[model samples]
Target: MIDLVCNVSNAVKAVDPKAKVYINIGGAVNLLYNDRLLGCIDGVLREELRSHPGPSGPEPQDPWETPAVLDTLAYSHSHGKTVLVGSRDRLKGARSLCVRAWSHGFIPVPQPAWTLGCSTPPRQFGAVAPQWLKATSKSIIRRPYTSIQYLSLFDIL
Candidate 1:
């Protein structure tokens, strides 16, 4: 596992020095590997790939106080870790996303604008909130909650 992580990390760095990558050993992997294995993974990271900006500042937070995927991503960027909250049930996890992000050590901040797609919904058009699209450490994503469509007329969101 350590070898694979090191090789992949090295490969990503070689491709784009600024490209960020994380080795996730959570969920099922946890069922297979114990704490010691996780520690070894951390050790490999420390020895081979240095953790940067140690304790740069306080934890990140969302300005709007809503559970948005973009905010979670922002938090991940500031912390230098890949943080993801599943979106299988967007409505169910909306606010919880913010809570989870807070617990996961992510730092949310104002982000730059992004053009996710052209909804062309007129005055009602939607996209990932501008604040959520701001720049952060490059990382993988699972789309923001704000991007979910199929709104109902009575939806109060």
Candidate 2:
């Protein structure tokens, strides 16, 4: 997964060499926290397991351990910095971060597909040609890759 992300970042950088990229180093969120008891309970239970006699060592830590990242982004946006985030989780912190960025006048680009497209592969290479290149070149130079390419002689009443 890291390799894939690096490859994508490199590809983007190759196209635009001066692009500044910020990568998120956090993982998925199995627990959540809010301002109320429900929020505290989940994280508290996980922390408790770390000190308990468990076979699995310890539970995973929450990703939003540092609110500084959010604060920095908010600050940068307030001072006119363009921040682009590719967030994968839907935690309360993630929502709060988005709200903070918006409040500070930053344009947050959420990666909805990153959270939703769990089963799909990031990239697939065909035996003949790559799908994106094929689709794009055909659409731009030749013709659109249409349903008619597969469906033929199907005109009915």
**Model 1 per-residue lDDT tens digits across residues 1-157:** 5555556556556765755443332222221133433322211111101011236532334343333434434433443443332222223333443344345543211111012221211123222333322434443333342321211212312
Runs off by more than 4 Å, candidate 2: 1-64, 90-100, 113-157
Model 1 clash pairs are 60-107, 60-108, 61-108, 75-107, 111-134, 112-134
The candidate scoring highest on TM-score is 1
lDDT per residue for candidate 2 within 21-93, as digits (tens), equals 3333232211111122121111110111111223654333335433444454444444433444433333323
What TM-scores do the predictions have?
0.35, 0.27
TM-score of 1: 0.35
Off by over 4 Å in 1: 24-82, 107-133, 136-157
